[model samples]
Structure formats: C-alpha cells, structure tokens
Target: MTDENQRVDASHTPLATPGPPGAAPAAPGRARRLAAPVLTLAVAASALGYVAAVDPYEPGHYPVCPLFRLTGILCPGCGGLRSAHAFAHGDLITALGANALAVIGYFVFAGFMIVWLIRAYRGGPTPRLALAPLYWWGIGAVALIFAVVRNLPFGSALAP
Candidate 1:
C-alpha cells in the first residue's frame, strides 16, 4: 500500500481498541477496596443483630473464662464480651463493671470505624496512625497495669 493510503486519517478520531480476547482479566484492586466497606458494614450489622438477640451475661448462654477460674487471674481481654453486651444494652455502669479497659477500647474502635466508613464512602484517603515505639510500649504498660490492678484489693473497682 502507498504510504499516503496506509497512514491513519488525522481528521478521523481513532477509536479505543478492545483488549485481547480470552486474556485473563486484570486483577481488580479497586473492586476489592470497594467490597471492604460493604463487608465491614455487614459484619457490624451482624454484630449488632447478635447483641440484640442474645445476652452475653446470661447464664447458660456464655461460658466463664478458664483463666479467671484456674488462677483467679484476670487477663486484659477477660470480660470483654460481657462488657460489649452490657454496652450494647445501654448499661454503661455494668459495662464498666465487666471490663473498664474493654469499654474504652470499644469506644475507640467505634470512633475509628466511623472515620474509616466515612472516608471510604467519600473516596478520601485512608487514615493513618503512626504510633512511635514509645506509644506501643505505653499501651502494653497500660494493659499490664490494668491486669495487675484489677486483681488487687486497691483496684477492686476495676475487677469484673
């Protein structure tokens, strides 16, 4: 063919060429990102539904912590479910009685989740928390303190 005839016409806009036929589709990271928020909402809804339907503190519905039974030692996570159940039922005092630290954690998590959902829906940047090593150490120390104090007579109020 002559060069003149072979050349694409500048006046005519080139249409987008379709991708390769039968080629494995490219991985969809964006779809995965979008799915995350839906999954999170589903999980939160399920949790709320469960909390509404069942009482964690009720006898025969839940089991006691083996650690609390064996050594009479309260772990950092002990009574967390009871705390959540109480909080879900709007019994703040009982929630605090069940696990003060866990109640605080629940609030922090709720705040974080709300922010995450808002950002996700708005197509905003994900929030980042860059905690220093000292901050991490401080968290561990606080948990240790909670564990120790809740077991002692002086910190009896913290105990479940």
Candidate 2:
C-alpha cells in the first residue's frame, strides 16, 4: 500500500480502545468519591473513642516513650496519647497541658479532614498540603524548639 493509503487507514482508527459495544463510559459514583474521606474520619473517630475509653495516665496502659526512657528527654510526640485522651474527653485545658503540640496537631488534622470531606462531597479533587521545602524546614525547626523548651526548667509549663 502507498504511504497515503497507510496514513488514511491509521487516521481512521480510534485513538483509544473502545469499551463494550453500546456501553457508555461510567463516571465515578458519589460513594466512590467520598469513600476515602469518610473512611479516614471513621478511623480517626474510632481511635479517639478508644483513647477516650482507656486511661493513658495509668501506668502500663501505654508504653513509655523510648526517647524519654533512654535520654530523659521529651520528644515532640511525648504525651501525645495523654493529650488525645484528654481531648477526646472534652478537656481542652488538660489536653493542652498534656501536650500542647499534640493539641495543635489535632486541630490541624481536624481542619484538614473537614476541608477534605467537604471537597469530596462536592466532587472536587483531593486536597494536598503542597507546602514548600522551606515551610517544611520551618515546621521541623518549630518542633525542635518545642522539644528543647519543654525540657528546660523555665518552660516547665510547656512540659508534659
């Protein structure tokens, strides 16, 4: 066949493979779109419920922080469980006292989930943090400062 005939045949062919005969391409259902956000909220609620039920203040209820155990230093995550427990029980003051950073984290996560759920329900694209590298470094710096200050005598109020 001449190049012109071959070109004509190729041009006539569909670019994408067709679906089953007489079948229309299906769009994602509302349930499918909302699945991720709903599942995430459910898991978080379950976890907080467990924390609320259990007493983390009691010894043996939860494992000791390895960093605190070994180095006598409180890491950023120290007292997070206790904070979560307090937060779950509706004691904001106690939650902040347990771990202020964790309380802040809880608020941040709650905000993110709220936005995600709203967007998912509206059939919008999934939300992304999209923080720049500098912002990430700044966050790390804040955590490090929090860790250091909480361990200091002057920052006793900040300590767990």
Maximum-lDDT candidate = 2
For candidate 2, write residues 1-160 as lDDT tens digits: 5676446565675556457745776657889989999999999999999989999988998899999999999998998999999999899999999899999999999999999988888888899999999999999999999999999999989888
Clashing pairs in 2: none
- Candidate 1 Cα outliers beyond 4 Å, as residue runs: 1-34
Q: 1-160 in candidate 1: lDDT tens per residue?
A: 5788677776884445446755565554555655776687689768866865787767777677888889989988888888878887888999999899998987887887788767776667766777999998999999999999998999988887
Q: How many residue pairs clash in each candidate?
A: 0, 0
What TM value does model 2 have?
Answer: 0.85
Whole-model Cα lDDT of every candidate shown, in order? 0.80, 0.91
Error of 2 at 132 (Å): 0.5
**CA displacement after TM-score superposition, residue 91 of candidate 2 (Å):** 0.3
Off by over 4 Å in 2: 1-26
User: Candidate 1, residue 2: CA error in Å?
Assistant: 22
